[model samples]
Target: MNEKLLNNTACAMVAPGKGILAADESTGTIEKRFKSINIDNTEPNRQAYRDMLFTTAGAEAFISGAILFEETLFQSALDGTPFSKLLASKGVIPGIKVDKGAKPLAGAPGETVTEGLDGLRERLVKYREAGARFAKWRAVITIGNGIPSAYCIETNAHALARYAALCQEADVVPIVEPEVLMDADNTIEICEKVTSDTLQAVFDQLYLQRVLLEGMILKPNMVISGKKCPTQADVSTVAAATLRTLKHHVPSSVPGIAFLSGGQSDEVATAHLNAMNEMGGGPWALSFSYGRALQAPSLKAWGGKVDNVADAQRAFHHRAKMNSLASLGQYNDSLETVA
Candidate 1:
């Protein structure tokens, strides 16, 4: 493992005032996003959408890295430039999503684990050669009555650790993600317990596997109320709980904690992150690795129209800039209306 290179890349991923752009939606996932905008889900359209994002002016100022889908890793821009190269040319690191979608965990009803470890080393080599310096693998943990059992959590954590080890071995920084779904009516307390347990297991497995902690990033869900909860926790409450949970579990050796905006609205996600940074003095950098929270407005602005390319890019830049400020605890509501 090129320890120094891994540490550099991992730190760069969570650089102050910058974060990762998770453009790594699977084909099916992007198709659903396109469906909302009335755009065809053709390869060319997908390529065009990403091209607009990658080419957005001033994005490099806020976007340190972009996590790409397997297909997008090999895709090219409208002008025939490889997407990976385009990002690198602008000083953004390229990353790939290495895990296949989550699957049902055996004997564990209503829970799932992420797959795709088979042949992952080979795939990592190819991705690195293709200009990817990092990779992401997400494990889904559903919170419901009697769900997310120890078996389910351990299974996914084990998979995440193995994947991280492989990534470091192949010279790629792994973003270890174990997302606790916020789709239930659970309160913030429930989310916190699950998140805490999930993280503890993940880190324990990472240690057992001997994955270099400083060389990988932790992309985790912020402790917050569930989407269906009658009363949601406020920004400060969520931030404090998330910090407490992470501080209790994640080691200081990790370079940073890049949060996944799991089902959060764009503004709310930014607000939560801003609140966390406002508290200050954490073991690692608290940043973002958001997908919908970062791209929803841009997609709406684009609306799949060729003439809206400039509008889309503007919207993209605006969102990225807001999150960038949020990373530094300098964001406010007034900035939301500036553009």
Candidate 2:
């Protein structure tokens, strides 16, 4: 299983001053993102957009790894270099998103379970051969009225553990993600409770499945208030709550926790992470594995224009650099105004 390789890769994914870039949006998902900018979601556009991000000068300084979708794994740069090869050349680990998507769970209203374990072992073999050293599987836990049932949490945790086992068996570090969605009107306390329970369940299943904790990175939602909540948490408050929940639930054996942006604005996400790092003292490294929070600015700058490539890349580099500084507790509002 190459345990050393898995552990080393997992550690590198959250190395000091670095984090993962979640460029693994599926076709449908990227389509929605592209639609927002009035860009046609064509193959060429997708390739170009990703190419821009990958080729951005100095991005490798902050981006330790890039999680790719299936198509992106095989796609090439404008110069014909494979995306995986391009990223590897820049000292970035290549990872794949293995989950099919979330589906409605029967008997659990307003809940979902992430699918795609049907042929994961075989797929992992293929992804490994294609230069992927890690993989991600996400399980969504919605917070709503009378929901996030025990059944739903258990079912998703079991799936995540199974997927992690498969990934480790194939020598691929797994990013086990159990996101407690922030789409509800719930308070920060409710978010904390849900995130804590979901993480505890995930670790329990990971133990039961015999997954190597050191060979996996946890991608969890930060303990924060819901979008519709009256009182949004301040940066320091969110950081403290997130660290408290993580320290209580996540085993120290795990190499790191790479937080999903969920629905946080780019600045807000970076601020929260910076606050956490400033507090320090966690057993494992804390970093980001953001999608929209990382990509939104770049996408807006690109705006489907060839002339905007440099601007898009600059925007991407700025965000990545901000998160990089945040990872080391060096970011501040002053840095935001620079350049």
Candidate 3:
């Protein structure tokens, strides 16, 4: 592992007023987007969409880095410049999502284990050569009645540690994402218990695997009630729950904790993050690693029309700007989303 490179990469990832843009949608996932727009999910179309994001006229204003899928890491723009090179030229670090899709854990029923780490070392070396400075691996944890057994949590945590070890060995900073899902109808207390347990297990595995905590950024879900819980948490409640849970499980040695949107409305997600930053007393830098929460409004505005590109960029820029503000505890939903 190159300690210097790891330190540089980690610092760049969480630079103030800048956060990651997760454009690393898988082929199947991109296909769904194409479906919405009546465009075929061909390689060219996928490349174009991603290129639009990475090559957006002035993305570096809020985007310090971009995460790409394996295919995107290799594909080139229309003029033949590789996307990785394009990002590097624009002062944005290029990262890759190394995890294969999550699969259902045998006997656990509702929980899933992320599969990667099979030949991960070779892949990391090649990605490093191909211009990737960081890599991400996500482990999904679900909450429910009689679900997400201890076996499921431990199995996922072990895989995450293995992946992290390989990343550090190849000079790549690892974004260790253990998302405790908010899809169940559980209370905020239930969500906190599950998230706390999941993070505790993840860090334990990281320690056992000899991973360097300083070179890793944690991407976790904020502690909040489930979507159908009949009672949604207010911004302050969500902020308090998330902070309390992280304090109990996450160590101060970790450099940052970027929260995943996990099906939250863009405004709500930003508001919650901003609230946490306002309430700040934590050891790690708090930020975001959102997907849909960062892009949904822009996508809906674009609607896949060539004429909508400028509008799309505008929408995208707005969302990015708001989240950047949230990162600094300065976002006001009423100022942006509220009319």
Candidate 4:
């Protein structure tokens, strides 16, 4: 393992006032997003949309790095620059989503584990050669009655650890994400318990597989009430709960906790992150690794029209700046009303 390279990549990923841009949606995922905006999900459309985000002027100021889909990793920008080169030129490290989507676990109803280890080591070498310095694999854990069993968590944790170990071997940093989904009607306390258990399992596996703690970033969800929950926890409450859970479970040896926005609304995601930082953050740097929350507004603004490219970029820049301030505990709700 190239320890120095891994450590440097991890630190840059979670640098203060900056976070990761998860423009790494799979083809099927991007299709749904395109449908929402009444646009065709063509290759050109995908490339154009991503190109707009990557080439946004001054976006690198708040964006430390970006996680890319396989297609984007190999695509080129309008100016004929490879997407990875364009991002690096702007000082944003390029990364790739290495996991295939989560598949249902055997005999575990309502639970899924991420899979991509079949040939990840070889792929990592190619990805690195193509300018990807880091990789991401997300494991999905759902919350429901009699679900998220120990079997499910353990299986996913093992996979995550194996992936991390292989990544380091390939000299690529890994973003280990074990997301306890918030799609149910569960209460905040239940979310809390599940998130803690999931983190504990992930870390235990990381240790067992001998992955370097300082060489990876943790991308987990914040502890919050489920989408269908009758009562939702406020931003401050979610922030505190998330902090408490991470402190109790995650090791400080990890470089940072770059949170996934999960299913939160854009402003809500920004608010929760800001709240976490306001409360003095935690032992790890509290940053974001958001996909939809950072892209929804820009997608709407662009609507696949060339004339709206600048508008889309402005929307993206605004969200990036908001989350940047949140990373430093400097963002406020009032800024949302501007522009």
Candidate 5:
């Protein structure tokens, strides 16, 4: 394994004033995004949609890296430039999504464990050849009545560690993601406790599997209230709780923590991240690896129309810029009213 390469890429992924873009939506996922905009989810459309985001005039200024699905990694832009090459030419490292999506855990009725380790080593080699320097694997932890059992957390953690080990062996930095979903009606305190337990379990397994902590990035959900909760925690509260949780479990050796939006709105997510950065002095870089939070506005602007490309790019660039400022603790709520 090339420890230096992995660490360098991981650090670059969360460099100051920048964060990762999760353009790795699966076909089924993109279909939903497209449906919202009245566009078909064909391969050509998918390519064009992502092409718009990748080719956005100066998005590279804020987007340090982009995680892509396998099809996107191997596909080319309208001018025939491979998507990975296109990103690299603009100084953005390319990454891949290796998880097969979370599936129902055997005995845990409502919990899930992310799978994809079946033949990951070989897949990593191909992904690397396709210009991927990093990869992501997500484990889902749902909070509810008598749920997120020790069994579910351990199984997912073991899988995440195994994947990280193989990724390091293949010289690819892995983004370890254990998302405790926000779909419930649970309070922020419950979310915090669950998030803490999950991270502790994941790290324990990572150590047991000998995954190099310095060679990977962590993509965790912020410690926030559930979507169906009676009231939501404001930006400052979420930021403080999340930072506390990370300091508690995540090793300082990890280069960065690129948080997942996990169902947060764009402005809300940006606000939370900004609040965290403004608070200052975490051991590792705190940034984003958002999907819908970064792309929703762009998708709405484009609506798959050729004439709307420029507008879509503008919307995309604006979102990226906002998050970039948020990463540096320079973002302001009033900036949302600009442009």
Candidate 6:
């Protein structure tokens, strides 16, 4: 691994006041987004929608990097510039999501194991040639009664580490994400336990794979109760729980921890990140790498109308700006609208 390249990749992904934009939705997922807006889910339509989001003016101000799908990485904008070139021109690093979708684990009934290790090295090489500086792979962990057995967590963690090692070898920073789903009626304590166990296993595999800790970013779900839990954790409680869990598990060698806003409302996700940063002095930098939580409002503002582009940009900018401030623990909702 080239030292400078690895470090540069890491820096680009975790630059301050600027987080990552997860525009890497799979075709089916993008189709779902298109369905909500009544747009056809054809290739050109999907490209156009992503083009609209990626080409938003000044998004580079709050977005240091963009995580993209294989299609977007190779596709050109309507103006003929490749998405990677557009991002590079604006000083934003481009990344790719390499996992070949999650497959149901064998003998583990409802759990999943992420696939992509096969030929990942070659894919990483091609992505780098196409100007991607980093990459992401998401591993899902579900919570429930007697579920997410050790076998399930370890399988996913091993894949994440394997992917990370390959990325580092190709001089690409890996955004290691092991997200524990909030799909059950579990308590905050359960979320904490699961998150802790997941990270512990993730890092252990990273160690076994001899992946460099400094050259990677850890993106994990914040420890909060299940969506259907009777009692919800307050912002402070959520922040404290998340920090305590990371403090006990993730080492200080890892540079930062940008969160995935799994099923959170835009403001709610930003508020949680803000609270975590406000608490301060944890092992890693707490920021965001949100998808739906960040894009939903902007997409709504757009309403698929060309005339609403400015409004959409404004809404997108607002959320990004808020999250940027929250990354520094200084966000104020009163300023959200005006800013």
Best by lDDT: 1
Range of the 10 consecutive residues with the lowest summed lDDT in candidate 5: 330-339
Across 100-157, the per-residue lDDT of candidate 3 in tens digits comes to 9899888777778899778999999999999999999989998877867899889999
- RMSD of each candidate? 0.7, 0.8, 1.6, 0.8, 0.8, 1.1
Residue 42 of model 5 has an lDDT of 99
What does candidate 6's lDDT look like per residue over 107-219, in tens digits? 99889999999999999999999999999999999997798899999999999999999999999999999999998999999999999999999999999999999899899
| Global local distance difference test of model 6 | 0.89
Compared with the true structure, model 5 gives a TM-score of 0.99
Query: Could you tell me the TM-score of candidate 3?
Result: 0.96
When summed lDDT is taken over every stretch of 10 residues in candidate 4, the lowest stretch is 330-339
**What tens-digit string does per-residue lDDT give for candidate 2 at 1-339?**
888888999999999999999999999999999999998999999999999999999999999999999999999999999999999999999999999999999988899999999999999999999999999999999998888999999999999999999999999999999999999899999999999899999999999999999999999999999999999889889999999999899899999989999989999999999999999939999999999998999899999998999998889999999999998999987787525
Q: Residue-wise lDDT of candidate 1 within 218-334, one digit each (tens)? A: 999999999999999999999999999999999999989999999899999999999999999388998999999999999999998889999989989999999999999999978
Residue runs of model 6 more than 4 Å from their true location after superposition: none
Looking at model 6, the pairs that clash are none
lDDT scores for all predictions? 0.95, 0.94, 0.86, 0.94, 0.94, 0.89
Per-candidate TM-score against the hidden true structure: 0.99, 0.99, 0.96, 0.99, 0.99, 0.97
Residue clash pairs of candidate 4: none
TM-score result, candidate 1: 0.99
lDDT of 5 by residue, 30-111 (tens): 9999999998999999999999999999999999999999999999999999999999999999999999999988878988
